[model samples]
Structure formats: structure tokens, C-alpha cells
Target: MGAAMAAEAEYGRGERATPENWMYRPANGWTYDQVKELVLPFDWDLVDGNIVVRGMAVWWHNRVRNRLYYQLESARRRPYAVDSEQCIVIDDHNAPKPDVVVFDETGLDIRTVVQIPADKAVLAVEVVSTGSRLEDRFSKPALYAGAGIDYYWRVERDEDDLPVVHEFWLHHEAGRYVPSPEQPTHTGKMTTNVPFPVDIDLHSLIDG
Candidate 1:
């Protein structure tokens, strides 16, 4: 088995483990420096005062993330920043590490667990993985929408390994994400005008 798979199996598949005070643990009392020092070669996040071990990203996942980050960052204007794999604290108990997060310059902090207030978050993007499908498709969207984030994007790889992007905008009154009128295409490219203008060439992002 691969390193990531081995780690997942050693830890547990997709289930959050209880917080423990170890050198590698990222709890409320731990500093970012400590987290960096101890969690080397492993992906970990702070969720509700607990240290959550995240499954490692496969090569394709990293590739798509890198490409998507570049596209968003290049098009991003002042006051908006695009980041990859940053923790966004949803509350005291939930901080998810999104594949990409675009947030405005408000409530920005210089802490280990950088907190992006829900209102300041313009968009949250999740590139779905086999182990993360349920959380990415349902749990995360609900959490982001409930936190008042305006937009969410879910990217999935089709049978051909090309990306299929789903766009959703929050319906404040309904407190959920309503699919945008512009449906995702199985071919060509995907574009969006909200939060900021971004055009993602699906082919380039995946195969290039």
C-alpha cells in the first residue's frame, strides 16, 4: 500500500479521532510552530480543539489544486486572496481544510489556526476524493452555507479522469446552496462570475 493509504489505515478511514496530547497533536494549546515541527510528512488539522488527521493528497489531487490555485490567484483582485489547503475555522468545533479558499480581507489574523470569519469568506472549493465524497458533497456544503459563505464549488473526476465542476451559490433565506443556472459541463471549460471572475479550462487543469 501507498504511504497515504497506510496512514489512513493506521489512523482510521475518514472518521475523526479523539484529540490527544502528543508532540504531533494540534490542539487549542499547541502553537503553529509545534504543529509544523511534529506533524512533518503528515497532514493534520485542528477541528474543534481536536487534532484531525487528514488523508494525504494523491498526485492528481495536488496537480488540480495547484492549477486551480494559480487560476484563482492570477485573477484575484485586491482585498481577496486565494489559498490552497488552508484551515477555515467554522466555529469552536469545526475547522475544515478546504482544497481552495478565497476570502476577503476581514477578520484576517496571524495565528496558528487562522480564523476566517464566515461572512468574510467569499468562496470555498473542495476537490472530491473517494474517501471524502460524503463530506465534500454534503457535510461541507451545509457547513459553508450555514456559516454564510456565498459560494461553494465541488470538483469531481469523471470516468475519464477529467474534472467535472459543480457550482453552487448560497440561498441566504433557504440556508443552503442552490445550484447555479449554469450547469457544469462534462467537456470544454467552466467559468464563474461570482465572488470574482474566474475561467477554469477543465482540460488544462486536469491533463496539463
Candidate 2:
């Protein structure tokens, strides 16, 4: 893509559009060093004007992420990035950060400028957070589907309840994902055929 297109896309993908964190705000842009210092200690993630942090009920999220990370590694897949708070610039005006992004390893080499497009991400995961259910279950799915991503996972964790739910959706048709009917209930495994066929041990991965 052209530089202008990429910049426009980046701006749209929500990297703290507002003046929060005193870093990349509209009024006064803080230096990279300043932003780094402010963020290094906290579990905060900036997306456009929104600041997302680990929710009070976030222990489950950590468990789920760790487990998934382990499974991916064990499978011998060269995941380009995981748990990096991917702020996919969908457009110049909006961006949402996904919890995990799996891409081809070769595309993430820092020295290369002409890398694969963000739309080429193989799979994306969202660990549900308080006040984030809609965004995770709805908004993000639509964005990923529109971008032609092959897989999207919603990891639902609730320490207060049993049977920590893990929902899996696979994009079958363009811009749409269809959940299987037998829908792997708690502790069941599901196989996805899109992007590439893979077996996922849903129960073992999400229920720590």
C-alpha cells in the first residue's frame, strides 16, 4: 500500500486519538519516551481515545492467554505476535486492539517495511473484559470478517462461575462466521477448516 494509505489506515485503527496519556494526543504530542515511561508500569493499552486496562476481573484473562500461548507454541506454529495488544488500524479514524494476533513469522521482521497487511492476520483473539462484551463479541467480529480474517475466538472467563465458557467462531463465508451447531460445549474440542484446518482443545485451553 502507498504511504498515505497506510498512514490513513493507521490513524483510523484507534491509537489514542484523544489527548490521553499525554503522549499522542491532538493538542500536545508527548515524546515517545514520555509515553513509554507512563505505560511501562501499568496494564494499560491505548486505542485511539480509549484507554483499556486489565479489568478488575482479569485473572481469568491472564490464565486463558497463557494457556493459549503455550498451546500455539507447542503446535510448532511460528506465531508472528501474541498478546501484543494489536491495534489494527481499520481506517484512519478508528482502531481496536485485539488480545492476541497470530500471523506468519516472516511478516513481522522489524527491518522490513513492506510487510503483510494487517488484514492478513491469520487469527485474532479477544479476552472478554468488563464493559467490553459488545466490543469483543460484536464489533471486533465484524471488523475481522470485513477484513477477511479466517478465524476469531472469544475467550470467556468468569471466576465467579463454573464451566468457564469458550466460544469459537470460524469465518466460513466472506464477511461472516458460522458457529457449528454441536458447538463444542464446555471442555469440548472444535476443529476449524478456514484459513487452515486445525484442531483446538477448547476446554483445556480456556478452563484453567
Candidate 3:
């Protein structure tokens, strides 16, 4: 909580902590290495210079992420890897971590801060939480698209607490995401061919 508060203070400073300071300022370095020390002691993200504390999610959220991870993992071929809660560096000021990210494995570093470049990412998926609905459905898609990321997916919980998946692809000419046509299904299945062929059984994945 101390690190979280410090990061928030730094963000509040606006122009005080410039990119130049990132090279020399000890506090700036601590914020940059949010995961290195236990100071922050939680999952945090930098969003347009603001520090976002990623608190724990509901059981359904974890279950959905795990289910999607394994599904994507089984479909993963050479040169592609599936990861959850990984940070994608949109720019120096913004790096929003997604729930599940599928990225190219070439030139990947397991050590240090694993900041996957937007271009190297095949897809960024966010399972929407009540606290993150706006960022997940709006801010993140815009940021990811603007960064030239190819694909984006949003998983929303319905009134019945069931997962509903939405998929989008980047339209470079428009510099925005174009939503994929909704799949017609009676059993609450979502299917998409972008990034890779993925068929998600939302009902089974959540209810199981």
C-alpha cells in the first residue's frame, strides 16, 4: 500500500516526474520496477501516468482467465505464447496490463520487466470487472488499437454472471478496433478466427 500511495503521489505531480527523471530518480526507478520489490506488494499498472491498483478479482474472473489460458495454450503453435496479467507497453506514459495476452515468442525475455511491445502482441484480452468496466471496454481498446496491436477481446459478465466474450480486430486505416460479427449460437458460445482460431464455450467455461 505504501508503494501504491507513492506511485499515486508521483502521478499527481503531473510534470514533476518527467521521462528524463526515469533515468536517475530513485523514486521513478522504484515505480518503473513495480514488480521487482515488495514495496507495492500488489499488481499495479501505469495508465497515462496514473498508477492503477489491480485488486483481486471475483472467483469467476480467475476461473475464466484460467480456462481461457489453457484453451489458448492448447491452440498455441510455434512462435506464439499465452500469458495472463502481463503488461503491454503502449508507450512511456501508458502500460495497461491485460488479463490474457497472446504474443510472439521470438526475442522474448523472461527476466526483468517483461514489457511486450504492442506490435509483437497478437491479442489482448480483458475480462471486465465492475471496477474496470470503463477501462476494459473503452480506454484499453483505444490504447491497444492506437499502438497498432492486431486484436482485442473483452469478456463481460451477464446478468446471470455468465461470461460473454466480444472480439475485435484493428482497422489500421481507421486507427480503431472493428468489432467482429457476433457468432450465432444457442448455447452461448463465442467464436473468432482472428489472431488464431478460438472457440470459447462460455457457459461451460464459467459454470464448470
Pick the TM-score winner: 3
TM-score of each: 0.75, 0.60, 0.78
* Regions of candidate 1 where Cα sits further than 4 Å from its true position: 1-41, 45-52, 106-113, 184-186
Give the best candidate by lDDT: 3
RMSD, candidate 3, Å: 5.9
The residue pairs that clash in candidate 3, if any, are none
Q: What is the lDDT for 198 in model 3?
A: 74
Q: Residue-wise lDDT of candidate 1 within 139-205, one digit each (tens)?
A: 7898899889988989888888887888898899999998886664435688778788887788898
Query: What's the alpha carbon RMSD for model 1?
Result: 7.5
Query: What ordering of candidates by TM-score runs from best to worst?
Result: 3, 1, 2
Better structure of 1 and 2 per lDDT: 1
Q: How much lDDT does candidate 3 score? A: 0.73
- Candidate 3 per-residue lDDT, tens place, 96-204, comes to 7899999987886778535787778889988888778888989889999998888888888888888887778788999998876554222388666667777777787
Worst 10 residues of 2 by lDDT: 26-35
lDDT of 2 by residue, 32-64 (tens): 222333443345443433444535546656666
lDDT of each: 0.72, 0.54, 0.73
